[model samples]
Target: MLLLFVHSKAQTVTGRIVDSEKQSVVMATIALQTLDSINICATTADADGRFVLTADSIPLPFRLIVSSIGYETVMPECASYAVGDVVLATKTNVLGDVVVKSKRPILNVQGDRIVADASSIIKGRIVTCAFDVAKYVPGILCKNDNELSLAGTMSTTVLVNGKVWNGGSVLEYLKTLPAEKVSKVELLYNASPDMHVTGAVINVVLKDNKGRELTGQVKSSYYNNHHNTFQESGSLFYTTPKWSLYSMYTFADAKSISRSQYLSHHTVGNQVYDIDVDARTHSSSLTHAVYTNATYNVSDKSNVSLSYNASFSPKSDTKGRTTNSYFSNSNYTTSGNSYMHNLHLAYVLKQLRLDANYMSYSNDGTQDMNYEKYENPTAYSYWRKQTSDRFNFSADWGFPLWKTARFSLGATYAYSKTGNRQK
Candidate 1:
C-alpha cells in the first residue's frame, strides 16, 4: 500500500523547461500529481520558461509531467522544491510521405462546413470588400460580377454573419461589405433548416465590434479602349454595442464599339445567290446603385435587421448600321432606362429566423429601324414598357439532433406579378 505524507509547512515548487538546444519552451504545460494519479497542481511556463506553483500540503514523491507543442513529453526525476530544469526533445518528422502545417491555418474544418479565415488573407493587400477576398478561397468561383459558383457547380446563395443578404445581387452585396469587418467565410455544404437554403451556402461572418466605431472606403477607376469607361464606389459603416449601420454606393459609365460580319449562300431552282453583310454598333450606358442596412441586437441570442437597395440604369443606348452585298442598307437605334428596388427585413432568435422581402423592377425602351433597297425605303418603330413586383416570406428553425447529425425544418412563401406593354 502507498501512502502520501503531508507536511505542515507549505512550500513553492519552481522550475524552467527548455529543449535540448537550451531554447526556452514558452507555454509548456506542467502538472503535479499524487501517487494515486490524481492531479493536485498545474501550471504553465511563461515566456522565459519559468514557472512557480505553490501547494498547501506537500505530497512526498510527487509525480511531475511536462509537455509542450512540437516536443516530446518529459517526466522529471523529482518534484521537490529543489527540482532542477526539465528538458524536452524536439519531435522529429521522419514520415517521408507528406506533411502540412501552418502557424495560422487559413481554413478550418467544422463538420459539414469549412471556414476560411478572411482577415488573415486580407491584410497587407488592397482588398476592400469580400469580393476581393473570395478569389483566395478554394472551391469558390467568381463566375462574373453578379454570380458566385461553388465547386464549378450552380450558383449559391450568400449570407452575412448568419443572415441572408437580400439587399441586391450576390456580387453587389459582396462588394459593399468591407473585408476588414469579416472574421471568417464559412462554406456550408449542408445547410440547416433555419438557414432556408436549397443547396450549398457561403456564409460571411463579421467581426463583433464592442464599442461605437466607424469605418468606410472609397475607390474609382478609369479605362480606355475603343471607348472610355469610368467607375466610382464607396462604403460606410458605423457600429455600437447595440446597433450597426452600413451603406454603400456605386456609379459607372461605359462606352464601346463592336464590329461583326455575316455571310450566307442560297440556291433556288438551279440559281445561286451569295450575300455578305458587315455591321458596326456603338453603345453607351450609365449605372448607379446604392444599398443600406441597419441591424439591432435585441439580446444576446436575438437580433433584427432591415435593408434597402436601389439600382438605376438611366441611359443605355445603341446605334448600328449594316451594309449588304445585294439587298439593302439598314440602320437601327435602341435606347432603354431601367431601375430596381428591394426591401428586406429579418428577425433572428437563436436557431429560428423569420424573413420578409419585397422587390420591384421597371423598364422603358424604344427601338427604330430604317432600310433602303432599290429606290424603296422602309421604316419601323417599336416601344416597350414593363414592370414587375415580387414578395417572399419564410420561417426556419435548426438545431442539433445527434452527435453527427442535425435537424432542420422551414416553411416559405413567394408571390410575383408582371405587366408588359408594347407598340
Candidate 2:
C-alpha cells in the first residue's frame, strides 16, 4: 500500500494604508472579501498603518476592501498579488442648506463630581483661550474675564491637573492655555479634605502629550471698539520620556474710553435744586506676561515639577474729566507700574503629594488732580505704593480604605505679609 500526503502553505496578505498626502492612516479597517461582496477575513491597521491578513487558503482573484473614518471606501481586485501601499482618498459631501439643531446635555454626574466635556462645549463655539472654556462650564460664571464664581459662591479656586496655581494673575495663566489642550473640566462642589480647599473648585484636566516630542503655537488678535487693542502670544512645549517643559509669553497694548452721566435732585429748607454731572475716562496700558513649567518623571508612579509665572505692566495711564452743573470742573490723571512673580515646586507620587509656593507682588502709582471751584485754580498730587509677599506649603496622602471608599489626610501652612505707603 502506498500513502500520499499533500502539503499546502497558508496565504498571507499584507499592506500599508496612507492618505493622499502620504500620512499614515492609523486604525483603518482592512478586510478581505469574495467576488460576491461577502466578507472573508478582517484586520486593522497599526500605528504605522500596516496590516496583515492570513488564511489557510485565499480564493483566487479575491477582493480587498479598505475603509476609514473621514475617508472614502476603496476596494481593489487582487489576483496572485501582494498589496504594497494602499492610498485612500478623503471623503467630502456637499448638501443644500439644512437646519438640524440639537442640544447636548450640559452637565453629567461622574462619581463624586460634575464633569463637562470641553470639546463638546467648544464645538460650534468660538473659544480663543482656556478662560473662554470656563464660560461654557455649567454653574460657573466668568465676569470681566478675570473673576470666576460657581453657583453664587465667590470663593472659587481653579486648579490644573490637581495642582494649585499660585501663578501671578490666574487670568494670565488661563490666557496662556489653549482651548484645544483642555480635555475636560471637573467641578468639585464639596472638595475632599486632602485638597486643602474650602470652596468650590474648577479643575482643568489638560490632554496628555505622551508620544509628542515638540509642539508650539502662536496667536495674535486686534480689535477696535472706540480704541485700538492688540495682543500677541506664543507658547512652546517639549517632551521626552522623562522630561517635559512648557513656556508661554504674552504682550498686550490696549486703549479704552468710557463715558458716564449722573443726575440728582435735592431739596433742603424748602429749596429745590437740580444737578447734573458728566464724566469721561480714557485709559491705556502695556503689559507683558511670562509663564513656564518643567516636569521630570522620577519613576512610573512619581514625578516632580517646578513652575514660574510673572506679569509686568510697565506703563499704564488713565485720565478722567468731570463737569457739574454747579459751575465746577475737575480733571485727574493717574500713572502706575505693577509687577508680580510666583514660583512653585511640587512632588507627586501615586499616593502622596507635596507642594510649595512663593509669590511677590508690587504696585506703585502717582495721581494728579486739577479742579476749578468758584473760578479758583487748585492742584493736588499724590503717590501711593503697595507690596505683598506670600508663601504656602502643603502635603497630602491618600489610600484606598475599601472598594468604594478612600481615606485621605493632608496639612497646609501659609504666611503672608503686605505693606502700603501713601504720600
Candidate 3:
C-alpha cells in the first residue's frame, strides 16, 4: 500500500493601519475570520502600525476585521491575499448634559521633550496657518512679526520633522504650511546635542499621507487697516507608495500708513525751548513666494528629500514727511526690490541623518532725501545694493543607551559671505 499526503502552503496577510488623519494607529487589533464568522487567525499592529497574519491551508475566502479603541471597526473581504492600508475613522458619541469636572491635559511630557496635541490646540478656534497655531503653543511667545522666543530667550530654532529649516524666514515658511497638516508639536527647552542647536527648539511634525493620493487647499485673506491688503495662497500634495511631492505658492500685496508726533524740550546756555515734530510714513510692497519639496523612500528605514524655496518682492516703496515748530521740514522717498532663494537636501537612515543647505539673497534700492532749515534747502540721494550667500551642512546620530537615557552625536559646518555697496 502506497500513501501520498498533500499539504497547502500557508497564506499570509500584511497591511498597515492608520486613522482618518493619516497618523499611525499603533496596537490595533487585526483578526482573520471565515465566511461563517469563525476566527482563523489574529494579530496586533506593531509600533509602526503594520500587521501580518498567517494561516496554514487557509480557506478559499476570508475577511479581515480591524478594530481599535476610539475608532470605528472595519471589516474588509479578501479573496486570496490581503495587502494594503486600512483607515479607521474616529468614533463620536453624543451625550446629554454630561459635565465633567476633570479634563485631559493638552501638554504632556515625552522623554526630554514636551508634546502638545495640535488638534486640541486648534479645536473650536479659527486657525488658518501653522504660524497661527504656533502662537497658541504653551510657553512660546511671538516677539515680533518674524521672531519667536521661549522663556525670554531670543535664540530659538524651528524644525520640521526633526530637520532644520533653512528656507528663508521661518515665519514665511510657517505661513505657507496649513494648520491641518500638523500632527503634533514638540518643544525642547534645553535642546539635545544631536539637534545641533544651542538654544530652545520647536519641532513641527506633519501627518503622513499614505492612503490618500491627492490633496490640496486654497486660502485667501483681505485686510483693511491704514490701507487695503490682500493675500492668496494655495498648496498641493501628491503621494504614492514610495514617493511624495508637495508645493505651495503665495502672493501678497500690502500697503501701510503710520503717523507719529514727538515733543521735546531743549536748553542751550540756560535758555529753554520747546519743540514739536510730526511725521507720517507710507509703505507698500508686492511679493511672490513659492516652495516645493520632493521625497523618495529608498526603504522602510531610509529616505531622501529635496526642497526649494524662493521669495521675490518686485515693488517696495516708502515715503515719509516730517515738520517741526523750529521751521524745519524734510521729505524722503525709498524704493527697492529684494529676492531670496534657498535649496536644501537631506538623507535619513533610521536614527542617523545628514543635511545640506544653501541660501542666497539680494537687495537693490535707492533713497532720496530733502531737508530745509530756516528756508535753507539741501538735497541728498544714495543708491544701495546688498547680497548674501550662505551654505550649511550637518550630520546627526542618536540612539538609545538604556531604558531611560539616550546618547547623541552630531557635527555642523556653515559658511557665509555678504557684500553691501552704498553711493
Off by over 4 Å in 3: 1-105, 122-129, 142-152, 267-270
- Give the CA lDDT, 0 to 100, for residue 25 in model 3: 80
Q: Which regions of candidate 2 fall more than 4 Å away from where they truly are?
A: 1-110, 117-134, 137-155
lDDT (C-alpha) at residue 23 in model 3: 85
lDDT of prediction 1: 0.76
- In model 3, what is the error at residue 65, expressed in angstroms? 47
Models 1 onward score TM values of 0.70, 0.70, 0.71
- The Cα RMSD in angstroms, rounded to one decimal, for candidate 1 relative to the true structure is 17.7
Q: Model 3, poorest ten-residue lDDT window?
A: 99-108
Off by over 4 Å in 1: 1-105, 123-126, 143-147, 162-167, 189-193, 262-274
* CA lDDT of each prediction against the hidden true structure: 0.76, 0.79, 0.78
Poorest stretch of ten by lDDT in candidate 2: 99-108
Q: Is candidate 1 or candidate 2 better by lDDT?
A: 2
**Cα TM-score of candidate 2:** 0.70
Clashing pairs in 1: none
Model 2 Cα displacement at 239 (Å)?
Answer: 1.9
RMSD of each: 17.7, 19.4, 18.5
